[model samples]
Target: MSGSETIGSYLNRLAAGRPTPGGGATGALQAAQGAALLGMAARFTTGEGYEDQADRMERIASRSEEIIRRALKVSDDDQEAFAAVAESYKLPGETADEEADRSEAIQRALLGAVEPPRELTRIAAEVIEMCAEIVGVVNPNVLSDVAAAAESARAAASTAIVTLEINIRAVDDEGTRDELRRDVERGEVAVATAATVTRRVRDDLAR
Candidate 1:
């Protein structure tokens, strides 16, 4: 999941039987797409009739550039994290000691894997917030893009929650599980905000 890979190439790899570039990576990309859309809308919210909102749009566009970079990095990191989990499962376990070691390794890998999607959920929340900010303020010509951004963020957060939940199940530590559950809750909040932003955009369009 190199950032430089073409969309077709990434899709081809994702469609393969491999474990990496799976749901987590896809979720990260969705967040990135949402952020990119927000950045575009913000950029269009400048000059002439938008004088009062220029500064706010500029700030959003700047922050969105940063979020897009972070999301792409998370996307790549997710593939590597999932690959580590897959490799941990391949560890030899013919004896009791080996089995214990293998189990420990798998648990450690699963714990490590949660961070990427957690970051993704955070990114989704940020994107959704930006969408909310620009929903009515952005250029009316591209107002629908705000809803599109919110929907993408919603999808990303939902997918990230699922990915994190699957990894959390294999993690035996109660404390860690509780922490991951909190993150899932946060992602759910972000999903709710995304829905709100989308609904607001829809109401605006209906008017």
Candidate 2:
């Protein structure tokens, strides 16, 4: 999606029979939405009662903006990366040399394809952390939005990790797979934290 692409336009493209803007891109967008909601909550967490937290809220707001930008860029990058993966599979491989070259290219492309979603999971984890920080402090008016943000981050992390897992499984390097496994572990932690945040919000609402 371009910087100016409408949501409807993007949805149309996503629904088409193409593969570039798939789960990885969707995961990035989910992270971006989560960060955006966090930013809004941070901005609202100000005024007389929130004076002691003004500096902290400001920092969260700033960092959330950065995360949102990075997540959107990741969305675009995932499209390009997945496109490269598809192209790598198309490489001519009839002969021995060509087959060897194609296999190497596909492995390289798969590794490259994993990075965007991996980064997205990191981003989602950070978003979840931010939500954890502000869940108790954000304005009551936007309290539920904090949970919404956490849930969005959870979805982002889950989707991105799935994408990462599939790509990493196809990758031949054991060391790289080990590293990605750690990233998946972190994504799981983020998902758990997101659930905690949602529960906290629900508890508060009950009270």
Candidate 3:
């Protein structure tokens, strides 16, 4: 899985009987798309008399691009981790002692699947916050694009949190489950905040 692989190719592989590149990967891709839209809005606003926010937009644009790149990489990581888990599941465990081995394998796989999406949720929340700040500041001509970015970020956050929840439910460790649940709650708060901010910005602009 080279970074050079196009999204279409990546998604095709994900859909092609592969266990990795599941919901976590899709959530990361959604976050990346949102980040890209944020960068686009920032770039469009940089010139054209939007000077007050030019420096901020430039910073946001750069950060957004970097975050998107990182997010895309995480998508690949999710796929790889999932594959590793699936492979572990195939290991033979015929003896009573092997029961422990199987449990360990399942736990490892569940952890692998959980961590990437948890990170995805955090990063998606950051992207959402950045978009919320820029929503009204960007070029009015590209307001819709800004809104789209915000919406994407919201969706990504929501999806990532859901993935986290699903994975947490599979974990036998109560402590780990509690921690993941808290993280998901935080991500949900961020998503809600971003949505409120975006909606206000959009409504104000319409009026």
Identify the candidate with maximal lDDT: 2
Is 1 or 3 the stronger prediction by TM-score? Answer: 1
lDDT per residue for candidate 1 within 86-180, as digits (tens), equals 99999999999999999999989998899998898889999998888778678988888989989998999999899879877888999988988
TM-score of 1: 0.97
User: Candidate 3's residue-wise lDDT over 148-191, tens digit each?
Assistant: 88778778788888888887878999999998998899789878
Pairs in clash, predicted candidate 3: 21-79
* Span of ten consecutive residues with least summed lDDT in model 1: 129-138
User: Tens digits of per-residue lDDT for model 2 on 124-171?
Assistant: 999999999989988999999999999999999999888878867798
Give the Å error, residue 190, model 3.
2.5
Question: Which candidate leads in TM-score?
Answer: 2
* CA shift of 6, model 3, Å: 3.0
Candidate 3 wrong stretches, greater than 4 Å:
none
Question: Which residue pairs collide in model 2, if any?
Answer: none
Backbone clashes under 3 angstroms, per model: 0, 0, 1
Return the TM-score for each candidate structure: 0.97, 0.98, 0.91
Error of 1 at 1 (Å): 3.2
Model with the higher TM-score, candidate 2 or 3: 2
